[model samples]
Target chain A: MRLARLPWWAIIIVAGLAIVFYSFFTSPLYRRALIFVTDDPRLTTTRFANVIYDVRTDEGGIRRVEGVFVGQRGDILNVETSRQVTIRVPRADIAALSCEPPASEGDCPVDATITLLRAQISGFLIFEDMGRFRIVTDDGERQEVRKFDVIIDAVQRTPENCPPSPEARCRVVLPLNPEREANQLSGTVLEANADDFLIELAPEVIVPVRQSDIVAVVRYTPAECALNNLVGCDSGIFLTLFVAVIAFALAVVIGLVAGLMRISDNPILYNAATVYVEVLRGVPLLVTLLFVNFALYVWLRDEFPKIAPTLQLIIAALALIVALSQAWSKRALLKSEPSSFWQPIVAAAIMGTTLVAVTGLFAANSDLPPLSRGILGLAICYGAYLAELFRAGIQSIGRGQMEAARSLGMSYLQAMRYIILPQAFRVVLPPLGNEFIAMLKDTALLTVIALPEMTQRARIFAADTFRVFEPYITIGALYLCMTLLLSVLVRAAERRLALPR
Target chain B: MAETPIILVQNVSKHFRTPRGVVHALRNVSLEVYPREVITIIGPSGSGKSTLLRCINRLETFDSGAIIVDGIALDTAANINRVRAEVGMVFQSFNLFPNYTALENICLAQRVVRKRSRKEAIEIARALLAKVGIPEKADAYPGQLSGGQQQRVAIARALAMQPKIMLFDEPTSALDPEMIKEVLDVMLQLAAEGMTMLVVSHEMGFARAAASRAIFMDQGEIVEQGDPQTLFTAPQSERMKIFLSKIIKH
Candidate 1:
C-alpha cells in the first residue's frame, strides 16, 4: 500500500533498475566480463594480451608501440603489431610494457615530440633526405591516438605552459622531444630501439636510424601504476547479489527445518535446534563468517572424510525411505493436494544436496572458494534469525486450530503441512522480505574474506585509486538500488498473497 | 437396549502439572454409549466432562485405565488416528479452520485422513452442508458466517468422515441467545437420525428432548446418571442437586 503512494517516476525508476539488475545478473557475457575484471591478476594467464610497449631509444626519446609480445631471442624482444608483423628490439631498449588501462593523473603520460641527433644523418637515416637532423613526434596526429608517452625525471610544467585542455597532468612539459633546434626534419616515430629504429618521414615512407645518435636513453616505469580501470567493481555488484540470493535461499530452508525442530516435542530435536539458534545468533555475523572461512573450513577439510562415509550411507537410506513413504502417502491426496506432492521431492532434494555437499568436502583438496564459504557463513547466521521468525509465525496460530485439525484424524505432520505451515508462511512473509534485504546489505561484510563481492570490488578500487568516497558512495548507491528493487517486488508479492479480509 | 457400546471409557484419570501444582482434571471417570443412544453430560467447570469426551478420541491422554472407541483400544499410539477417524468431535468455540471455506473445512479431513477422492469428498461435504441446513453457505468462510452457522459447519466437518460416534463439548455454550436454537435444532435432528452422540452441555431442554440418558459430574467424577426423564425431574446426590440448581435456576 505504501508503494501505491509512490510517484510514477519513482516506480518507473525502480522497475528500470530491476530490469537492469536482472539483465546483468542473467547475462553470461556480463558474468564472464565480471570474472575477467574480478579474478586475481597474478593468477590470470590472459593478462599479457593487448600490451602497449614504451621503448626508449639510444636517442633520448620514448617510442610507443602497441603490440602482443611474441617469443624473445637472445637479446631481441619480438613484439608483434596488430598487422601481424613482428619487430625485433634489443632487450635493453624496451623501457616498459603495460596491459592495464590508464588511470588518472601522475602514472599516465602526456604527449611529446622527439628530435633526432645529426650523427646518423646519411648512413642509416637515409629516409630524412637533405636534413642535418630529423624530429619525430610521438603524439598520434598521424595515427590513432592510443599511446601514452610516459615521461620520467622531467621538468614540471607550470600553469602558464599547460596544454589547451589544461589538465592537472598537462602542466608538465613532455620529455619525448624536449629540445627542437633551428633546422631539424620532424617525422612520425613508428618504432624505435637502441640498435636501429624506424621513422616515418612521410605517408608510407619509413626509414631506419642507427644507434650513434646524439642522445641518451633514460626512462623508468612509474612506481605506482594504479589498476584504476574499476569496471570490475560492477562485477562486484553481481557477486553480492548472487551471494545474498543463494545465502537467503539456503537460510530459508535451514530456518524452516530448524524452526520445526525447535517447536517439535521430541527432546533431541528441540534441544539441538535450541542450541543451534542460541549459538549461531549469539555470535556476530562477521565472526561467524571469518571463522567459517578461516577456521571451520580448515577443520572440515581435514576431518570431513572421517565421518562422511557412514553419514553418507545413513542419509542416503533415510532420504530414499522418506521419499518413498511420502510418495506413497501423497498418491491418495494427489487430486486434492497437488502441491503437497512436491514436499517429499523437496525433502529428498535437500537431503541429496546435503549428502553431495558433505561428500564434496571430502573430495575437495582445499577449502571451498571464498564465495561459497561466505555464502555458507551468511546462511548459517541468518538461518538462526529466520528460524526465530518462523517459530513466532507458527506459534502465532491459536491452539484451537491444531485441536480442530487433530480432531479430524490428521497426524501431527499432516496438520502442520495442510493447516499450520501454510498459515505460518503467510504470517512470516513480511519479515522474510526484511531479512532478505538485510542479508543483501550484510553482504558488504564478506569483503573481509576477499569474496570479490561488490563491496570488496569497491574497496579494491578505492585502495587502488586512493579515492575513498567515490567507490564507497558508488557501491552504497548500487546496494540501495538492489534493496529498493527487492522491497518493491516483495510488496507486490505480499499484496497478491494477502488473504481475503 | 443390549447392543454393544460404541464407546467405553474405563477408570480414565488425567492430571495437568502446572507451575503451581498438579491439578487432577479427570479422577477415575467412566462412561459408555450404546449405538444410536444419545447421552448428555452436565458438569461445572473443571469437572472432567470435556476431558472425558476428549479422551474418547485420544485427544487427551489418560493417566490410568483404557478407552475403546468402536472396539479399537486407545492404549496403543498407532490406533489413535484410526480411533479418531471413527470418532468425530465438535468444540465449544466452533473451531472451523479460518483458512477454509465451509465446504473445504468439511472436505479436508475426508480427502486427507479418509483418503477419499476430491470429488467424493466434495460430494460428501455438500451433502453434510445440506443436512446441516446451510447448503447455500458452503462457499463462505468461517469468518463470513455467524456463530450458529459456524458451529453447524463444524458439526458437518466432523460428520464428513462418516464417524460412528460424535462428541460435543459444550457446543451451544459459546453461541448467542438468538443463535443457540439453530445449532440445537441441528443436534436434535442428528439425535432423531440415531447418530450415536455424547454431548456435554447445560442445555437441559435439549437434553430432556433428545437424550436417552443424562449424567451429572462434580469434582472430576460422575455424581449421578439415569434416564433423562427421571434425572431431570429428581436427581439423587447432594452435589447433583446443587449443580442442577445452579444451572437450571439461571
Candidate 2:
C-alpha cells in the first residue's frame, strides 16, 4: 500500500520555519522594504539604493547616511526622487510592480504585501539598486504623489533595499526633515504636560500623532551630580543572583521530599503529592508570578506588619517549593511505578490541576517582586518533572532482581542499593538530561514576575529603544542556543552513563 | 549406633491458604533423619514433599507439628534464620541472582549470613564451584550460562554456606534432560560425602543409587517407606505398586 502521509518531523520543521520566516519578513522595517519596492521604479531598474538616513549604531553613535546600496551591476539608485522618477519610465522598461490587498484588513500588511511585491520586483531590480526605495501604502484606497516623509518615521540606512513591485512604483524617496523646514519639531522641555511631548531632530518630518497610538509620556528631569554610591549595582546583581541560587537550592530540597512522598505507601502522602504536582504544573508561570506579587504580598503584609516583605519572599519561596516538590514527587512516583494503563492518566490529571491552581493564584497577584518570585515559580514548576526522572531511574530494575537478592538473605533496602538502583539509574540518565534542558527553558517564565533574566533583559533593552522585534529575536536565538548546548551535554552524559552495548 | 536422630518430625501437618480456599498440604506426617544419612522423598505432584522439606528450614510454617533439628525447636522466629543458615536449600529453578557472577552468587550467603571476610568467601566460593564441576564458569552471570551451568552454580551457592544438612527440592526438575545428569551428579557426590540430605525428587534411578531410605508420599501422607531396592523390586502397598508400575512404564 502507498504511504498515507508526510513525515511528521518534516511537517513540524517546515511549519516552524514558515512561522519564523513569516515573523521576520512581516516586521515593521521589513514592511517598509515591501512598501519601497511597490512605489519606486528606479529601484526596480537599478536594483540598488543609496538611502541617507540617521541610524543608532551598536555603540549608541548616531550617524547620518551611514550606508549606501550598490546593485549587482554596480548601479546606484538614490533614495531621493526615485518614486517621482518612476512616473517617467516606459511601460516596457518598467519591469514589474504589483499591489495586492492585505490578507487581513485589521491586521498589518507585512507578509502578503512583501511576498507579492518581492515576486514583482525581482525581475526588474537588478540585485544592486534594491536598497534606495522607500514605499508607503495606507488602509484607504486613494493613491497620490506625495513627498516622502523620512523624518517622522525614524529611518535607518542599510545597504539592502526592498525588492520592487509589478506596478513600476516600487521606490519612493520621501523628503528628509519636513519638520525642520516647518520648524515644528522641538526636543527641549518647553512645558510640563502629561499627554504630549515633542522631540527635535536634524532632519525631521511632520506627522500627526494620534492619542490612541501613544503608549507613554515622560518629562525630562536631569540631576547635575554623579554619585558613585555603588549600592544600587550591588543590590541589583546580588538580588538576581540570590534568587537564582535560592530557587535551585529550594528546588533540590523540595524535590527530595516530594519524590519520597510520592512513592510512600501512605495514601495521604501520595494524594498530597498528586495534588501538589497538579496545581503547580497546571498554572502558567506568569499568573503564578502575579499572585505572588499581589495577593500573597498583601496577605503577608497584613499578617506581619514589620517583616511583611521578608515574609512575602519566604512565603513565595515556600509556595513555589511545595508546588515544585509536589510535581517532582508525583512524577517520580509515576516513573517508578510499573507500566500500567492508569499511570499516565493519573499523573496528567494531577499535573493539570496543580498547574491550573498555580496559574490562578499567580494571576490574582500582579505586584509581587519579580526575580525572586519568578525563580521560585519556575523551580516549583519544573521540580515535579525532575522528580519523575528520579523515580524512573529508581524503578527501572526488574522484580526478579529483588526477589533473587532477598532469596540470598539480603534485606529489601540492601537489595535495592546494591543490585537494583545502580542499573535503574543508568537507564534514566538520558531522560533526566532532557528534564534539565526543559528546566533551563522554563527559567524564561520568570519574565512574567519581572525578573530580568536574559529574556527580560532583552525586553528592557527593546523598550529603551523602540526596536522591539530585534530584542525578541535575539532572546529567542539565545534560548535556542542554550537549549541546544544542554541537549548536547545530555547526549554526552547519556553516552557516559550508558550500559555496555 | 542408636544416637537420637539429628532431625525429627512429629505429627506435622501444613495447610495452605490459597485463592481457591484452604489446602491441607501435609497431613500428620512423621519422619526422622539421622546424621549423615541420605533420605529421598519420592512423590507425584501435590504430594507435599516440598512442603515437608521446607518446614525443616522454616521457609514454610507447618499448621500442626513439632519439628526438632539439632536440639532446637523450629517454630520460633529466634532460631528461624539460624535454622535456615544451618540447613541450606536449593530450588528447582536455581533462583540465582542474575546480575551477580556465579562466584558472587556462591559467596553472597557466606559473606552476608556467615559474616565471612570477602577473601574467605571468595576462596570458599571457588572451591564450591569447583566441587560442582563448573569452576571455570564462576566468573559468569547466571544469564550468561546455560541451565545446567546455572544449576551447578546454585548448588555451589548453597554449599558455600556450609550447612549441616542440604535440602534439594526437585533440584533437577527444571533442567533439560541432558542438563539433569550434571545436577544429579553433584547431588550424588554430596550424598557420597555423607551429607545429611533430605531430597524430594522424581528420579527413580537416583533414588535407588543414592538413598539409604526411600519414602513414597501421596495425598499429603507417606504411604510406604523401605530400602530403595525393595521398594522398586517389590512394593508393599497397593498404592506403591501402582505408583511404581506407572513411573516404570513411563
**For this target, which candidate reaches the highest lDDT against the unseen true structure?**
1
Index of the highest-DockQ prediction: 1
* TM-scores of the candidates in the order shown: 0.67, 0.52
Q: What lDDT score goes with residue A492 in model 1?
A: 87
lDDT of each: 0.71, 0.60
Candidate 1 chain A weakest lDDT stretch, 10 residues:
A119-128
Regions more than 4 Å wrong, model 1:
A1-4, A7-175, A178-234, A266-268, A295-366, A466-469, B16-22, B75-80, B229-233
Model 1 lDDT tens row, A260-354 = 76876445457778999999999999999989998988887777667677777776776676567667766754543344566656756675678
lDDT of 2 by residue, A187-268 (tens): 2222212322111122222222223322332221211111231222222223334454566566655665577567755455
Interface RMSD for each predicted structure: 7.2, 8.3
Residue lDDT tens for model 1, B1-250: 6888888888888899999999998888888879999999998898888888888886776778888788888754457778888888999999888778899999998988889999999998899899999999989988799999999999999999888889999999999999999999999999999999999998999999999999888878888999988987788888887877887775
Per-residue lDDT, model 1, residue A365, is: 48
How close is candidate 2 at the interface, in terms of C-alpha RMSD after superposing the true interface residues?
Answer: 8.3
